[model samples]
Target: MPLLHIENLTHSFGATRALVGIDLKVERGEIVALMGANGAGKSTLVKILSGVLTADGGTIALKERPFAPKTPHEAAGAGIATVHQSTDIVGVPGLTVADALLLHRIAEHRTSLFVSRSGLRREAKALIDAAGFSLPLDRDFGELAAAERQLVAIARALADKADLLILDEPTASLSSEESQRLFDILRRLRAQGIAVLYISHRTADLQAIADRALVMRGGRIVASFSRPIDFSSAIQSMIGRRLDAVRPDARPVGNPVLEIRNGQLAATSVPFDLTVKQGEVVAITGPIGAGKSRLLSAIFGVGRFACGEMFLDGRPYRPRSPAEAIAAGVSMAAEDRHRSSLMPAGWPGHSLAATISLPHLTKWYRKGFLFGNRERREANRAISRFGIKASDPLASVWSLSGGNQQKAVIARWEAEPSRLLLLDEPFQGVDVGARREIVEAIRVRTDRATLIATSDPEEAYEVADRILTIDRHALLPTAADPTTNLAITGT
Candidate 1:
């Protein structure tokens, strides 16, 4: 019998129907993967199952018993827990490892307020050890790395005694090694008879851990398959068509467009040399803290190069700051769109307009206050061009879905023409339609020279004309050459 079951689930936001008549089931100890393009209702279903949002209509059952959790706390109480892709840990600086663990125990009411510190510490230690984490018991959780933060989230879910674990894009930012460690932990959890609902865009991770796969499109589950499924067929189902042909702009390589000669960032210990050409996409792949980010930052002028030189379009260009980089015909779409790219508090129209008319805005802001009417007009133009889903231009960015939020970020860069574009994880949480749109946009930008960095090998192979792997702070050419076989590897 299935451990959890859903039937005829439907949901919407205002007039927008986000999900329609969806059904799914997870058997005991099974790892089920939910695959779809961004905005395909995968997140909506997750929200319903995790009790973060109520469904408009549906029936849910667990162990053949009616199941309706009213709150996230209730969902945990009923043995379902979800770990979101974006880490949401707060107040960590004030809380010790033991305190964080005990807080979970307190949330579940497993112990009284007067619980002994020694007992809490002992239990916390056991959980940490069991999860293969080696943090000091008294250390603050805020000091831990990104992977450690994820492990802590998993530990908290385990503490709830959850029977089903829903992980959303858990490996998006992880390095190859950190990702392998996470897979190890998932295997351990599976061995303990825990069912997993895995959500991710990377086909490699899905193939590694999932027992069953469900492809969602247009707010519906359109296809389902058991294990040993073909990767190409699965992707085709998710995208609703074959994506075998290389993008038309992905032309044969030519002369270098941008060159980095013995570049070094003293603050980050990144020393590398590389080049990107017109009509070619080059990817930089490495593990977390491998200085891949720092390398991009240095190249894009977010950080200064302490030594070496950079040439853009055959002209010496060492930008002192991001503004200088933009002035030199370079733009970067950051990895953390919410914090780094989007203006969270600004009105959607204002943000879109600012990005679309950045070159003019930069000049206008220097002279005087921006004309509100003109700004809105430009912003509206960008919104329509990018097909951004929002009711009003004045809507706050926080009101949009994750995929739409990402699209807004892409629109910012796409509005202005540049000599070289640098994108970091451009499709992180984007849906299928949005992913296709973004990829097509990149393909179009190939005539303008583009470089993208991603952790997913399949994504790299899909979008890049050449794959460059970062190993020991050096860039090495991969087998993604036009004439060579595409052989992926970790260094």
Candidate 2:
């Protein structure tokens, strides 16, 4: 019998039908890849399976027995574990990895007997080893890098005695190396007869470890494939259209729009010089923690450089904060939508209109005041242009799926004009189609100098006029021959 089985799953949010008649199965020792476009009901199905939400009409079975959990803890106790895109699963900010790894045990022991710290550390170390992770047990869980924190969450799940594991976009924030390590761990789990449900937008990941693939469209399972999958066919099934190459529209480059000279990202790091011309798109690529973000932060006024000079259109520009950056015709779409970008409690329109800091959007007598109709009009226009899937403009930003949420964040930045645009990992959780649309929109506009910071070289190749690498906290050209770094054919 399969480890997990679902039949006729249907769910809705008010008038919006999120999922409709979904059926799926995952057998032990099998790894299944779930592919879908934004708002295709993938997140809704996952939530239903993990007990975060209940299905309107459906039946679920584990080991051929009826199963319906009322809460996440109930689901975990029943041997189902889900790792969501957001790291909020490991909720305690100050908890150590050792403690997090043994959280289940600690929670189970409702006795006065205290557990030994050394003994717990040894146990946690054993669990980490078993999961093929090298995370430091002594480090605070929240303080670790996003990838490390994700690994810690997975380790904790494994330690809790999981039989069916669900991972949602696990590599969205991880570096390539970290993702590979995670793949290795998943393979080990599969060998041990653990059922795995891997969800991702990355075709490369599906190619690497999926034993089978299932494509979801409009909240229904539209296609499935066995091993040796044809990824192009799978992607086509998910989006209901032919996949196209994501190349930015070619445009002319003009005079320099921004320049940085002797900018020190870190106190002890060497200074770097860079220039971006109008109508040019420059991509900076590097591994995580390699200063890609530092460069972007410095430019956007989120972080200060130790010593340097920045000029915007031949004028001295040093922004002390993000507001100042915006005031000076600089727009930045920050990474980590959940933390820095999305307005969790605000409506979608509110989130989209937040980026335009113009007095017209805020002043009472102006046309774009929040209480007036301008913000709503802009939000509607952005939703149509960016392909955001919110049914109502007043719907909370937190209600959208992760990929759709990412689109909303990027749309906010692109809605208004700016001299320079900074996008950091804008494609983190975005689907290929939406990513292509966003890149095309930004590149085709050719109204500003856009700087994109990403860890994926393929993204750089697709959208950038110039590609630079961050090494030892400094930026340098990837190759002397600029043509060699140009977009690939078909792009």
Candidate 3:
């Protein structure tokens, strides 16, 4: 019998139906993959399963027993734990690894009284060591690197002793080595008879870890395959069709649009030199802690280089801040869009329009208010151009689906006539349809220079004109063919 089952799962946001008549089942000790293009209701289904969102019509059964969890807390009590794609830990900047894990346990227990901190710490230490990690228990989480942060999140979930664990794109930002470590943990969990529901866009990972695969589209299970399926066929099912093999375009290379010589990331010893020509799309891929983000941030001025000689369009240029990067005709769409890109409480229309034509709106800031009509006009134009799904220009950005939110951010940057575009994981949680739309928009900017960083090899092969790999804090070129999985190495 299946460990968990969903029947006739349907969900709608207002009049828009996000999911319709979806059915799925997971058995004990099974590693099942839920695959889909963005907007196919993959995230919605996961949300429903995790009790973060309620389904309008559906029945869920745990071990043939009717289960209707109203909140994440209720779901946890029922032995279901979810590690969401979006970071949701509170006071993450201050919490330590042990503290974070204990906090999650306390939350699951829902206790209002004092707990034994010593006992919690002892248990946390055992769990961390068992997971093959040696992180300093007293170090603040805010100081931890991205890979370390992810490990802590996973450790928290495992500490709950959950019978069913849901991992949503856990490897999206991780390097290959970090991902391998996670996969090892999953294997351990599987051996313990705990069921895992893994969601990811990286086909290579599915082949390595998943035993069964379920493809979701338009909020339904369109296809499923047992183990040993070909990777190409699995991708076809997830995308709902075959993708044309990407070939490098034969275009004349123009003068260098961006150049960095002996760039150092603050106090780090990792230094590299790189360049991008006009109209070229370069990709930087690497294992976790390989300094991919630092490189991009240094160039974009989020983290100023300690020492570097840089040139933009044949002129000396060194931006001290992100605003300076923008002023210099460079725009970057950061990986953490929820935290960095969107102004959650701000007006959506104004936010979308300001990304492209913002200097005009800045004049109104001094007047202490914005002209709604002007903001709406520009926002509406962007919404139509980018195909953002919302009822009105005034819709809250937080209310839009994840895919649409990503599009809104992309629309903001794409509207600008930028000289250099740095996009970090432009399609991280986006659905397939939106991915195509976003790619098309990027491709249309043939006159501008662009650099995209992604962990997914398929994304790099599909969108990049040239691929660069970061290995041991250095960048090296790789073949740009989509047919083969390129092995990134330090040269």
Candidate 4:
């Protein structure tokens, strides 16, 4: 019998049906890939399987026995472990690697509080080594790089002896080399009869790791495939359309809009120079920790630049804060939308009306009291322009899918005229269809000079008129083909 079986699984959130009559099965030693666009019910299904959410109607059988877990701890005890996209669930930031690995064991000792620190370290080392990772056991888990944290989370799952593992966007923060190491580990786990349910937007990862593929759209299972999967068809199933490359035609460059010289992110970093022209899109591509994000932060005035001279339209421009930058005709779409951008509790209109005053969609104060008709009108226009899927314009932004939320945040900058636009990792959790829409929107607006930061070469090729790389704080233009020349400053 298969290791896991589900029949007629259905779930809903208020009026929105997240999952509808989903049926699936996974045998031991099999790796299944789940593909879906944002809000396609992938997160809902995973939550039900991980005990984070209770399915309204469904029958699940594990090892030929009925199984239903009411809590995450219950799910873990039932031999089902989940590693979500964010590593926060692994453990608190202050905890050591050993503590993170054996957190459950530590929590289990309710009566006798005395725990053996030496034993925890030894056990944690064994788990890390078994997972083929050499992470420092005594180091604080939060201080490590994103890829290292990902490995520790996987190691923790293995330590739990979970028979069925669910991984959501596991490699989103990992480097290509680290991603390959993880694929190797997953293969070893599969050889040992561990069933893996993998979720990701990266086609390369799906091809490398998954044995079978399942496509979900509009809260339903639309398609499934065996080995040697047809990825194009799978993507089509997810988005309900033929996915096309989002390459934008290069527009005629105008006079320089912004110029920087002798700029250093920090006193110890290398100095660099760059120039951006109106109607031009320049992409900066580099590996993590290579200063891609640091550059954006400095330019957006969130971080200090050690020494630099900046000019906006041939005038001196140095902003001490984001507000100052905004006043000077500059706008930024931050990297981490959940933390650095967006108010989840706010309505969709509040998010899109942030940078510009869409008078029709913005509420003009009446007798020192606020109204929302204009805000609603502005949000609806943005929603229609970006094809954001939502029941109404007044819906809380937190209710939308990851891709749609990203769209709303990005669309906010387009509400007003800006001389320079900055976008960092704009397509992090977005699918092909949404990525195309976002790129097209940015391309169509030829009045502003835009700077994009990404680690993916394909994304750089699709949207960037010129590609640059950051290394040791130095920004240098890459050859026409970014894939062949990945090195930036050779740090």
Candidate 5:
């Protein structure tokens, strides 16, 4: 019998069938990759498995025993652990790495036996060591970097006696090296006969770790690829269509719109020079701390360079704040949408129309009174232009899927004309079809210069006419040929 077996699992929300007749098996000592697009029912299925939802109809067996958990704690008790895309340690670093790792244990034993701080540290240290994770047990959780923060979460999950580990977008924020470290840990877990269900959109992550690949589309398992997987085929199955035979639409590059001379992103970086022409899309690719977002933020006036000069449209541009940047015809979409781009439904100005019209409210006001009709009109226009799948402009932006939400955010910036458009990891959690739509939307208008910051070279290839890398917080020279990078080389 398999370690985990599911037969005809099905679920629905309202009239929408989020999951339909799903069948799968996970064996011990293996890592299985789950591939799907956003809104393809992956999140719904995961929620059911994690005990956050009950399936409408299905059967799941753990070691041949019927299994149904009613809560996350019950799921944990059943030896199933889920680590979400974001590294979340509850009541943690707010509390030392050790405290975060052992919060539940500490809470359970604190009243029975008083343990000193040093004693708690030692216990946590031993647990992480046993799990083969190298972490500073005494350090504050907040001090850890993004990769380290995720590792701490994984270590804690594994130490809690997880038999089957489910990781969602585990390497979303990790560098290549950091991702390798995570892969190593996962390999060790497989050697110890643990079952792992890994979900990711990254080709690199799947190529590196997945022992088997399962593709899901339309709430069903459409395809599966075994070792020596045909990745091209897997991607085609996941997206359910062949990628375009040619580039979407490549426009001619125009005169220089952005110029940076002898600039340093941080005090510890070397000087660099760069230029972006109007009607061109340039992408900056680098690791997490390599200052990809920093470069975009610098241009948007939310971040800075140690010493550098910038010129927009051949005029010196030095924005002191985002308002100044906006006034100068510059707009930017940040990396994390939840914390930055989006607001909950109940909050004022959270609707699709309001979100798109937020920064341009001054233009919507006449005699000190704003017009909702114009806002809704513009919002509907953006939805149509960007191919957003929202039926109502007045609906909350949160009602959209991850991809649509992202489109809405980018639409917010694109609504008003701008000289330079900045996008940071615009395709972070989106899938192929949505990614194509976003690229198409960004390319349709050639009136402005577009600069994108991302860690994925493939994304740069898909979106940018030119690709540059940064190291040590310093902008690197762009290659004479855009396809010089190995990632850009066609296999």
Candidate 6:
């Protein structure tokens, strides 16, 4: 019998049907890849399987026995474990790694109240040893990098003895080497007869790890591919369209919009000089914690550095805050969309137009009242400019598909004219179709400078006119690319 079996699974959120008559099965030790663009019902299906949501109809059988879980705890007890994209935020930031790993046991009173701190550390260390991974039990969970936090979440799942593992974009924030290590671990798990349902937008990951592939669109299983998966066909089926395999040609360049001289990312880092000109998109590539995001943060006026001289449009420039940066003709889209960007649907003034106009509300609303229809007009203009999938500017942004939501965010910054625009990991949690749309939209403008920071080298090449690399907090010249014939220079 299959390890997991689903029949006629259906679910809905208010008026929108999220899942419809879904049928699936996973045999022991099988790895299944779930491919879908945002709002394709992948999250909804995972939620049902993880016990975050109960299916309105259908039946699930695990090990040929009927299974239904009412809560996340119930799901884990039934051998289902999930590592969400943002699993880093699951534990208290102040807790030590050992305590963070033991949080569930403590919550369920599975551990003795009298256990000492050393005991917890020993227990956590043992779990890590048994799982064949390394982690610092005494480190504060908050201080761990994104990759470390993700590993911690995975370790916690293993500790639960879960027979079925669900991973959602597990390598989104990891370096290529780190990603390979994760794949190795998954293979080991499969050898142990654990079934895995892997979710990701990265075709490389799907190819490396998936034994079978399933595409979901509009709340239904649209297509499924077996071994020797036709990835190109699978992607087309996921987005319901063929993508232009070519990167858009670069726009013409002008004088520099942003220039940095004698800039130091860290106190001990190499001093560097950098320039980004109007109509040019420059990407800085690095691993996590390599200080690429730090450069963006400093330019966006959210982070500070010990030494640097910046010039904007041929004038000495320094911004003390984000508002100051915006006023000086600079706009930034942060890496974490849900945390740093986005006015979610339920909040007051959370319409698509409102989200676009939020940062400039002082000039639009002024004090307590909205002045006129200008906000809506700009919102509509952005919507059209980016080919956003939304027809109404007044609708909740959360209702749009995943790719469209990112388009909305990019549009939010693009609505106002700026000399420089910054995007930090702008492609997070988005699929290839949406990514290409954003790349096209971001490059179409020839009047401003665009600086992109990404850890993915392929993504850097796809969107940028030039690519730079950072190592040990030092900005380094990119090796000459034969395809582009560009000599990138830096420190």
Tens-digit lDDT track for model 2 on 1-491?
88898999899999888889999999999999999988889999888888899889989999899988888888888898998888765745688888877776677773224768888889889988987778889988777766677777787777666899999888877888888988998898899899889998888998999999999999899999998998899989988899766555456789888899888888899788888889999888889888888788889998888888999999999999988888889988777767676644654334444433222344333553356356566668877887777876655677877766777777666666789999998888777777777777778767789999898887787778777888778886554544454632210
Instruction: Compute each candidate's TM-score over C-alphas.
Output: 0.83, 0.91, 0.88, 0.87, 0.88, 0.92
Per-candidate Cα RMSD to the true structure, in Å, reads 4.1, 3.4, 3.5, 4.0, 3.7, 2.5
Question: Candidate 5, 267: how far from true, in Å?
Answer: 2.4
Question: Which wins on TM-score, candidate 2 or candidate 4?
Answer: 2
Supply the global lDDT for candidate 4.
0.80
Pairs in steric clash, model 4: 361-374, 361-375, 361-378, 362-374
Instruction: lDDT winner between 1 and 3, please give it.
Output: 3
- Cα lDDT of candidate 1 equals 0.74
Native-to-model Cα distance after best TM-score fit, residue 77 in candidate 2, in Å = 0.9
Q: Ten residues in a row with the worst lDDT in model 1?
A: 482-491
After TM-score superposition, the amount by which residue 265's alpha carbon in candidate 3 deviates from its true location, in angstroms, is: 2.7
Q: After TM-score superposition, what is the CA distance of residue 100 in candidate 3 from its true location, in Å?
A: 1.9
Model 6: per-residue Cα lDDT over 1-491, one tens digit each: 99999999999877778898889899899999999987788888888988889999999998899988888988888899998876644576789989888888888998988899889889989877766667788888877766677778877887887899999888887878778878998899999999999999988998999999999988899999998999999999998998756754645689999999989878888888989998888988988888888899899898876698999999988889999999999999887665567775699767888888888887666677885387789878877777776658888886676567778888888777899999988887788877887888888888999999898877887888888998877788866867663445552
Model 5 earns a TM-score of 0.88
User: In candidate 2, which residue pairs get closer than 3 Å at backbone N, Cα or C atoms, i.e. clash?
Assistant: none
Best by TM-score, which number? 6
lDDT of 5 by residue, 241-284 (tens): 88762443455789999999988888768888888888888888
lDDT of 3 by residue, 1-491 (tens): 89999899899988878889988899999999888876678788878878889989989998789888888888988989898876646327777667776775566565434756676667778878777665677788777765567777777777678889999888876767778888998999899999999988767788889999988877778888998856567667767678666544546668899988877665556677888889777878766666677778877888867777999998998888988888888888887776677764565433444433454445445676866776677678768877787777777776666777888787777654789999888887775556776777787677778888776667876777677887665676655444554333222
Tell me which residue pairs clash in candidate 3: 37-431, 37-432, 38-431, 38-432, 175-288
Give each model's clash number: 5, 0, 5, 4, 0, 0
Over 64-176, each residue of candidate 4 has an lDDT whose tens digit, in order, gives 88888889889888889999866756776799988888786768763235657887788788888888777889999767665577788887777677899999888776767
Identify the candidate with maximal lDDT: 6
State the displacement of the C-alpha of residue 173, model 4, in Å, after optimal TM-score superposition: 1.2
Q: Show where candidate 6 strays beyond 4 Å.
A: 128-140, 343-353, 370-402, 484-491
